[model samples]
Target: MSRLLDEEGLPPGMLAPLDEDPGPARRLSRQKSAALVQAAVLAALDAPSPPPRSRRRHEWLMGGALLVVGAAAVATWHLSRRSDSLAPVETPVVAVPAVVEPVRPEPVVPAVDSERAEVAGVMRTGAEAGGDVERAEVAGVGVMRTGAEVGVARAEPDVAGVGMKQTTTGGTEVGVPRTTPDVAVPSPSAKLRGTEMLPSAPAPEDLLRRANGHRATGQWKAAEALYLRVIRTDPQAMSAYVARVASGSLRLEHLGDARGALRQYQEAQRGWPGGVLEEEASHGVTEALRALGDRDGEARALESFLARHPDSPHGVAARTRLREISGR
Candidate 1:
């Protein structure tokens, strides 16, 4: 093959046998090429390999998880901020001062007239006695004196006076009995019959009128007594209602007895509920509560009064008092 190659103009060493020893320079070149190829192979083995499809999928999932965590944190922060903004704000409390009312002076009652009261008392007694007593009126001083007594012995008594003498003393007659068979003692049935003929008690209307007269004259005790009599006589009468209300007013204003006045007013209200004078009684209840220093009760009473009597004459005052009690 070598002889053939030489004939074809090929190099002589190119056709050397495979078993023949190469020269040092050729061997060195061959060694260098082998070393370069090994180095390339080692570099290829040492370099990092690309991840597999499954590993790449896991990495993507981790990245997505990280992104989701960041988004969740951001969303939590936004939601917390929104909640803080939407939270209710506390309001500061302010104290209000109480309203005070001015004090007023008490009313003064007029002095009682003695002579007029005396004459009134005498006339009242004579009228109540049912025409049994004789009253003599002195002209200038207006004084009254009792002239005679009823159911007394007379001079010509006991069957036309069998020897009876009439004795007169100080322009008055005195009866004396002598020891005689014709003079007879009076029995107890005769006295009882005489007592039975007297008149009954006065009417409630008359008693109320008399009480009003006494109250006007400043005879407070007498007026109160007569009013009580009227009330006791006829509790359901209109005159009794008037008497109770008047007595309440008298006790509250003139007598300065608030408790007594309250009783009278309450009794009138109970006796005559929803009557013509109900508004007056309700108003009086408020006044009584006010006088007793019961602020809450007074407020309630005033409210009730306004509700019941919206167009009452005292509506303005009732509203004013209610506002005062409520500290408005």
Candidate 2:
């Protein structure tokens, strides 16, 4: 094949190289290339390959976990701090019932001992005061007298023949029998029968409650009577003002007794002058007069109320009523 290639004018080496051994330079070059490829492969394996997508994702996940752990720790610490800051509430102690003991009776003194003690005290007092004290038997009973008493009795002449009896005890009464008494003693039964028990007066609050009950039950007469009684019983009391107003209202609305209502309103105004009920009483008076067809009286009452209490709670109503009654 080489002879044929030379005859065709081909390069003799190109044809001959194919059948020859490789040169040292070519072998060196191939070895160097193989070394470079091995180095590149080792570098790709050992020298930090571009961080893996999984590694970055793991870093992010780890960071998020660290943040979550930090937040949880902070939250736990904050909760613990808050719990420590709060004070513990103290519970109230209940009192136990005390044990009760039975009452003891007082000791009684003997009559003889009491009498002897009294006699001894009297004798001691007589001796200290330089007075003579003597005990003698008179009419089969023991008697005692002082020296001053004996002298006074001897100086005075006794008109009656009644004998005197003395007792050693100080508590014993000296009974002097009288021939006649001015006042007669009443028998026990007669005394007991003569004991007159007055009826108890009703309380103001009770009367008000009863009156309100009756009013609620539509018992106007009974309610009015109770209200009147409360007003009459305690006119100076605050409840009386309420009763008077209630009575006036009952008379005006339920009974249609305008004159009686007007009287009650007037009395309430007099009893509670410039008081909390004054405006109400004045208004009630005007309303009662209006109900009775007394236009001039209504007008006058309204004018008085408006003048006295221009800034009263019912001032507007009073002014309006006055205007209506005055035909203005």
Candidate 3:
């Protein structure tokens, strides 16, 4: 009777059967309920109760204890399930480090034309004889006899090409033209009436006038050489750099002097830091690199230009070229 009542969550008792004659539904007295339940249990066993009727209280306690034990077991199971969900998970890690590299400046190459060095003497001799010089002059310094000497040089084959001629003497012919003493070359010029000029000024000015004339006559080599002399004596003559680049280009293109001519332009760029020629000089380098079929060098130069001069008009052109090269 106790086990059956506990399974149904009810007290361990079965009251008297329905009283059809009752005026209202009323529960049976505790003693009557206990007796009924005991009677049923005793009948099932086919024997009387082993314990006295006082043990009926113990049946209620047994049912309550079983319920408490079931509730504790359910609570413990739920707590264990919740704890599993709260456990920490392990996280994976990656080891990555940032690296920096030092940037290097562009390399510098001297514009010394060794091939031209031999031909230069030949060219100077030709110029001295007023021979054909489509392109003339070196990047740094070159010479062409100036003044009425232009026509005279044209007739003189000896001065056509480059050669070491001693300044102290008329070339290797030592002690020919008498050497002037140091005191002979005066400091400040003595004013003649309202004008004053250095004695040697006549030579350079004459050479300048002659250089322009040669340039007009398409005597680039002659013009170039004269210009170099002027700039050599006067570093402020910025035009010298531009003229050299032009002369070098023509010579290299026409004279098969690719190496020497390229050097000339390269050297000119080093000194020409400003002006229209400077812009042209940059292009000249690109052109030279292309002429040499140095695609890698040309591409690198274009890339460098874009990186350094983002705002330049050429920057867009360079970027466009790069994209084309990249096949984009």
Candidate 4:
């Protein structure tokens, strides 16, 4: 009975003897202890064992290493394919010919008919003038003559179909007919002679006369141009002096250019001091000063003019201007 109660998970002191009369409370207590012991055994049998820490960590590391190796293999394969696709391809080389330029033909110069005829006439005249004539063929078509006086004549044909004749003086002449008749040829000496015959420039007096003609015709600019040409041609001549005076008068009277007139008059005065035109230049200076509204300068110039040329035709006007400046 004690063994049975022990197997049923009962306390040793709770077991009763089998010969004693058992009550219902004792039986119910045994049944309840058996049921509690069976429940505890079932719960202990159903619980799972705890896993090992080192094995779990090792498994996770192996899986991560496999994943990394797979990714590296995939990346290496992709890079290799990309490099192959971008590789350069070789092309065949072809040889090309260099460009050649066409050559141009030289121009052909035609010979003159008049020169050819004159040369032929000269050659015929020399042959008839009673000299020993030794004839030789020149360039297969022309005749070369040797005379009593040492002379040689030569004719040659060029690529342009033109014939050339040369004459030498002891006494020989050769002529070849020209193919073209329209062209006229002049020698270098003739060109120089023509250049020497060109007309010379006009004289200063002629330029002055032209200037006077233009002035009379009311061509003021043209007249001035001619006067300037005369002055430039011969500045020290009487024509240039007259041009200065005339230019000053024109500027003063027609152009109303007091400053330009004064400049001309002053130049004339400086160029020919105390000359026959001194009275005119001095009076022109006074007039220019008056036109410019320089009363003091005009007064001084007038006094000087009167002192210099008292017997002049403009002396009365100079004295009157001086008196006006002095408030007399």
Q: Can you write out model 2's per-residue Cα lDDT over 106-170, one digit (the tens) per residue?
A: 11124334644665564444333321112111122223322222111101111222232210000
What does candidate 1's lDDT look like per residue over 1-328, in tens digits? 4335344643323343443233222322222333444444443455333544555566556556655665665555555557657763531212111111111111111112343355456544443333211211111222221111111221211111123121110100001111221223222233234332224555444455555556546787787777666565545667567667777766666677666777777777877898666777777778777777888988998999899987565787889989988987
Superposition TM-score, candidate 3 onto the true structure: 0.32
Please give the clash total of every predicted structure, in order.
Answer: 0, 0, 21, 0
Better of 2 and 3 by lDDT: 2
Instruction: List RMSD in Å for every model shown.
Output: 59.8, 60.1, 48.8, 63.9
Off by over 4 Å in 1: 1-198
Question: Weakest 10 consecutive residues, lDDT, candidate 2?
Answer: 166-175
- Superior candidate under TM-score, 1 versus 2: 1
Report lDDT per candidate.
0.51, 0.52, 0.42, 0.50
Superposition TM-score, candidate 1 onto the true structure:
0.39
Model 3 stretches with alpha carbons more than 4 Å out: 1-198, 201-212, 252-255, 274-276, 304-328
Candidate 3 C-alpha error for residue 12, in Å: 99
Clashes of 2: 0
